[model samples]
Target: MSAYPTDRQPTHTPVMLSEVLALLNVRRGGVYIDATVGLGGHAAAILEASAPDGRLLGLDADAQALAAARRRLEPFGERCRLEQAWLDHCAAAAARHGFSAVDGVLCDLGVSSLQLDDPQRGFSFQQDGPLDMRLGDAAEQTAADVVNYYEEADLADVIYRLGEERRSRRIARAIVERRPLETTGELAQIVQSAVGRGPRRRIHPATHVFRALRLEVNRELERLSGFLASARGLLAAGGRLVAIAFHSLEDRIVKRFIRAAGSGDDAGFRSLSKKVIRPSADEIQRNPRARSARLRAAEAV
Candidate 1:
């Protein structure tokens, strides 16, 4: 297990925290689940709001994150259970921890601040680190493996399809020419050179490519889709299922899933929000990362 420092607290700020608490409707004696409880920001709040006898199950794929969460939530005693598991295994983990039927389930999807802020994790472009971007230890392949070994055509396809980059072909060609890349800084420089570092660019030139590799390395979309298919099974009647997605790809999946699940007369679930929820200007100022977050909610019928 990765050792997290206890001298100082983690700097993770839970996105739309108030909104999540409201949507979950946490109450005393109720049970809840944080499907991606990074650093236990949301989990701690959930436990506090559902005070007295409420219980929570926190699941995460990253061992380092779980360690941090365990420390942060230790004050809650046995009211919360932390597990090192992915979103897809939430149901099984919940069941194992006596949370078979929960009052709420929250999935905060995509890469987290915990991963991005750590230079050694290689999830950021700002810092130079190894090209490894595996969110979970179980993942055998890393971003290095993908960029160093994938065929140009396949790499282009991954960047185009997953990253939604229009110049994926050009980027892939550049990457192919620079094989055996071992560090994030090296890859970022190559991409910037190939794509041109124009002043007009709103975001970094390598943003799309890095996001593509992270998604592919973690298989986030595939696992999210599978988790959503059976998510309702873990909820009790009227229990809310809330998701916070950081990117367009993840937001689209959540939007479509809730829409489809809530349709028809005999639907098992109903959409709680007709429109997507976003952070306030104050929130954006405090934590710039919350600017891209989109929240969608549904309730089991």
Candidate 2:
């Protein structure tokens, strides 16, 4: 059922595919960039819609994801160019690939299903694995380093500021009490014990803690801010910029950046949607991960 090769194909679906393509206004011969092209699902669709002449430059932080993307996008031959790099370097990568000004730029922010499903990557607490949560090999620190080395106050601050966890102090105290935490399972158990697991709870007790560590480990927020600043320059006049953010922190950044870019005398963009776009109920049912996706679009002025 997948367009990718049968061997080692990633199982993730592209979230809000229709909306992204529509908002991008993809057309034949148009050049585009997928700033976080995880697994190439959206890239493939964009390539297909663009038909014979459309060219795409796909960038990703994970080498493994880039490998999968390379295989999936190989059918398009020279029409697609992929680079293993973080979102923040999209403009540089685009320039290197001769895509200085593109018709559209898509940034599907946050961890992809490929990273979360792989226990070794340690983005989730559902399975036991190393505490490393770096999105790519370029990152210096891992979740283990943050959990085991940071002081209680610093840890609590990170959790509270990034994860917006109300019980960050309690959670940080618990983590400090159990120092030198090595695995995801160990960390998850400690947090659950500290937070008190209840049958009525909607999500795991350690969800925010894990999210915080991953974000901190990867410096995702900082990189996202940098990328947004460069995105306006990367787009040609009338070009579209489509961003899909998974959590409030990321969504809030995108919302404010677009709002500011669309106003004032130096106005560079015009927001395409008055309201944030969310996945349809059917999409959420098909892929539960789609439920949290928030899509925002703007056109370069």
Highest TM-score against the true fold, candidate: 1
Question: Of the candidates shown, which would achieve the greatest lDDT relative to the real structure?
Answer: 2
Badly placed stretches (over 4 Å) of model 2 are: 1-7
Q: What local lDDT score does residue 291 receive in model 2, on the 0 to 100 scale? A: 98
Cα lDDT for residue 225, candidate 2 = 94
Residue lDDT tens for model 1, 197-221: 8899999989999999999999999
Candidate 2: worst-modelled 10 consecutive residues by lDDT: 1-10
lDDT of 2 by residue, 93-186 (tens): 9889999778999999888777888788888899998899887889999999999999899999999998899999999999999898999999
Q: Hey, what RMSD does candidate 1 come out at?
A: 1.2
